[model samples]
Target: MKRPSRRRLIAATGAAAASFSLAGCSSDSGNGDGTPTGTSEPTTDGTATQEPTTDDGTDTGGSGEPVGADQLARWVPVSDAFEFDVRAASYYDADLTALAEHESDFYTGTYGRVAQSLLGAELVDIVPPESREHVVQIVPAFTIVLRTSMSAGELATAVTDAGLSETGTQGDATIFEGAVNSTQSTVAVVEGVVVQSFGSNAQNAVETVLAARSGETARLLSNNGEVRTTVDAIGESELLVVAERPEDASSNDPSLDGAIALGYGWQFDADTSNITIGVTYTEGETAEPSALASYLTEQDAFSDYGNVGSSVEGRTVFVTGDIATNQFDLLSAGTPGESSSATDAPQVQIAFEFEDGTMTVSHDGGDSITASNLSLVVGDSPAGSQFADQYEEVTAGDSVSVDVSNVESGTNVLVLWSDGRNSQMLAQAQVP
Candidate 1:
């Protein structure tokens, strides 16, 4: 993991009432273990020595947000499965905001640099606010590790077992447990390929940071208890799709669904925008090349995007839009057939699946919203923000939008999903 920097980091905080912060980034490197000379694994007593803070001229405040161009390349081409990094930090700052900002800035910066290239959603922060501020001064042994072996279920279990769930006072310095969020791994799949990543905050805050690392120092930290790893192999003769199978739910896994929405904006049905959901399964798990068609039919969430599926797929296959709406133009919205230009406009949109569930949108202001009208452009950043400057600032709410378009700062977005594959809910945003 990276360190903090001495900079003016601030956010007026407005949007879907949901917002949090923390820090770190990525860099290009040939896999080299950087476990400190005497570093150990994390334990109840909080073992695992961290890499020494950059001594003034040494390495202080870690890397800046978003991540460097080089590093992004390294992490992406490296692997597809979820990864994690166990980072040990010397709580040296009392300003938890700075602590969170320190780390978030890095990831935010990462978005600017490699936003499109990012493979999965991310976690900007997760540690305890009080802890980030309290652990200053002491060179807490920092451990950086990564993983691609375990499923979301397993990862959650490990983090819990490691006692890294508490945001404070666990003596382990871990916050944002069960934080399932990422940028890249959010997609759909037929034979297996992470399809898409689900969960954003969890990734930047927990998983990605804990994923396999590079460089000598990275290895050392990974070896320590601070970081744990799990790996598995699908059959060469078949692809393995490891989806969540809940006994109580008719949809995929409610927990997994929520985790994906928060992280990747994944919606069900003909929802290409919300591809990052379910679980990390292999393509040839059984004998199905793409259970997607079959799965949708089974769930009854299938629909046509815009009557396009009619000329192709089959009587059963329909575009995501057609299944959920009377009108849909995905190609126009994302491909070259569309044309639009604006000043400082970012992506914003409320997405939802009627067959699946609804999502909620929370604003920074007193207003809390719930609609399927998510948009791609938001007005300004800082103290006061708005949905294209039309709606008032948001406090909290949800939407049925499974995925959203154009994500950026000062924008309020939300998903009010039912977490049921078989459930039906529409997403919308209320402006003006």
Candidate 2:
């Protein structure tokens, strides 16, 4: 990873002036009513009022209001199981539509086509595009909500038209189950909202989200003080991602060692896209702004693409980066370890699963590689050397299996990428 040039760092410092500024940081005080203290009241219209805009229309800092809480408040409370809470408000800002379109593959790949079916053209027509907001909470099992203008009958007609059938009902919510792109999913549709859950216990997940949305259960923004403070610090943006850091987050990188939560906010511009990466440190832990700035600048995606800047507010450290519109493609090239400069040894992430007597290796993401270029190298020679030659191309989600029952459980398995002349380890795992 290359360091940002001195000129670029200066440019980044100037850009950071216009990017998200820290309103305040690390306030755990909350009203007993579940609402975190320091948040503004919601507007009469259901949605929370946004921060005041500048003369040219960009959001100016210092309102101290948690701008996007209305959407986050519609989801279940952040718990041990909650991994990512994402809000995409393309309707509010047309700029986000382009950004979302560019990252469509990521959404569909991560959440699967179930997300596409719910957020596809059909529902977009029923929902008021300008005011519609999509919130996706991933606990590994997804709980998605689309704030819409469609009534119950209209939503039913749209979902039915999309080949979904009513599976059951929970209170005022109607649950529908169906397959999109051969993937099974279930969604709960209630007045002015469409909820979906993908993975096991879909119905139960939908119910949980509905309970949170109706204020029957705890809401994330109101109950989770850590997340509330982090989000407020990041302020408003077109896309916001709030992820709860793991308790045992021991990272080789010093900047991430004691991270408690991560808040990422992106605001698009006519010529560039500005991103703010905020990391909440554990209590009593402090962040080194210079180290954070250097660490973030080296991130593969942003390495040579833009200027990087950093600032510390209380226990939260915010690193802001700007990427030019022309260089935007680098952001989708996959993260550091998942990608490389080699053309023959394409970037790929493989997951190895040992079951019964077989070891299945699946391509989770990154570039697609020719079958002949990949080899399962266990010890010196893999159990099934012919596994790679069986398929013409191995793509994301594609899996190849080899008989590993004879191999010891403690042996190591490696997925090697090669074009005969050159070879590199794409992924490796210990036999378990």
Model 2 C-alpha lDDT per residue in residues 119-162, reported as the tens digit of each score: 33234444544435444433223344665556778877777787
Error of 1 at 144 (Å): 14
Tens-digit per-residue lDDT, 1-432, candidate 1: 000001000001011111111111111110111100111111111232333332222222212222211221111211112232111221111222222333332322211211111111121122212221111111111112222233434444444553334332211113333323211111111111111122232233223322212221232222211111100111110000111121222223221221111111112222222211112221222212234323333332222223322111111111122222111111112221121211111122323232222222333232233222223211111112224344432233432122223333112222221111100111212121
Question: Going through the candidates in order, what is the number of backbone clashes in each?
Answer: 177, 0
Every candidate's CA RMSD = 20.8, 14.3
Would you give me the overall lDDT of model 2?
A: 0.48
Q: Give the worst 10-residue stretch by lDDT in candidate 2.
A: 22-31
TM-score, per-candidate, Cα-based? 0.22, 0.57
